[model samples]
Target: MTDGQFAPTVHDDIELARKMLIGGEWVGAISGKTFPVYDPADGRVIVEVPAGDAADVDRAVAAARAAFAPGGPWRSMTPQARGKLIWKLADLVEQNAERLSMLDSIDSGKPINEMRFFDVPFSVDVLRYYAGWPTKITGDTIPISYPAASGGRFHAYTLKEPVGVVGAIVPWNLPLLMAIKKLAPALATGCTVVIKPAKQTPISIALLAWRCEGSFTLNIAVIGSNITGLKRTRIRPPTA
Candidate 1:
């Protein structure tokens, strides 16, 4: 081996993508428009990714809503099972730490050392921390003040429940970590998610989203733009 050879700086062997993650599949935007992502270090186009708009966002939201619906695979999973899935995701992050660190470094032009030391580990930590939340999330019983209105002998309690689909819009500066911060808790709490990674740095998020494939009941999609808000539903606390 030559002593003067430098470590590999380009990742030609790694396959990058120009699609978005929608409905558990890698797909292109309906408009077929793609915007180039530049390597911050050299200003050269690293890759082109789908330039998703409202339509793409809607598709992702629909998928998330279906996954979050009653009796759906993601919703029907027991809390303990959900926790295990999240823990598995954490393991996946750890396993791909090096690749992820490289992607972030290339995308954001941050030093590889920073991504390796901070962003990557923190993302894994966030997922692991939230993994324990599923089993621990609990509701409590409360004393009723209007007993007369309740036949003078009624009980009241609250059930902590999922808020359905979550929309996560993360910044480019710390793409991986910020995305995990929004996603880990949502996954732990039994909600599906639609993530819009900032346009400048979508590659790492795309990879992370695809990593969820075959890992669990897929409950996440990576795309662009904003999904329409969920209809407001007032859930009354249970009473007996």
Candidate 2:
């Protein structure tokens, strides 16, 4: 809906579900457990999200590996093609600006004007900026020579490539913007990703995954389990 469609307020009127996105599909937690997400401004239960734990992580990671593995769609794609996909995402983000902006504002208890005017716009810019980067990635040869084991000197050069799959674990604070920040760069670099949005605010991210699924394989699977081996920084609410 347009800003005018919402008319007097930006509070969104939409239906949200409690599920996780894995391998391009949405499903309930593997354990079938769920948690309530409340509107921060008031203590009202807005939605229920799958309570993902370690098992979910394993599923997502495996799917990501397959999508980014050699011969996979993302792996076989050219950097330019990857850039084009990212650009497409930028277009989608622009098209859904109002809805996404309103979503994060309500979910995070932030001001609508702030999210609509600043956060959402900045995220689009970041996506656009990174969208231009995929095709421009380059490497240069070094003037310094490298001596071989046999004492022969030769010029050295370096090349860059995508690092395969990526995992984007996002926070509830500014969900859309932060998600775009991580996702845009990863996609630009041709790395497939499995993104886990904060349970408290996952609607926007769920929408993003669904939107992209039409274009990419998105080998997403349900990941309610918390897989280990990654460091996580907790974001605490501001102190008085």
Per-model TM-score on C-alpha atoms: 0.86, 0.81
**lDDT for predicted candidate 2 compared with the true structure:** 0.68
What's the C-alpha lDDT at position 218 in model 2?
44
RMSD of model 1 against the true structure: 6.9
What TM-score does prediction 2 earn?
0.81
Candidate number of the best lDDT: 1
Winning candidate number (TM-score):
1
The digit string of per-residue lDDT tens for model 1 on 1-240 reads: 122222443243123457777787778888888777777777777766777766676677787877777987887789899999989989988988888888888778899889889999999999999999999999989987794576575678999898988888888899899999999999999888888877777777766776777565467877742222222322121121
lDDT of 2 at 232: 54
lDDT minimum window of 10 residues, candidate 2: 231-240
For candidate 2, lDDT tens digit of each residue in 150-178?
Answer: 56666788888888667777788888888
User: Model 2, stretches more than 4 Å misplaced?
Assistant: 1-17, 143-155, 215-240
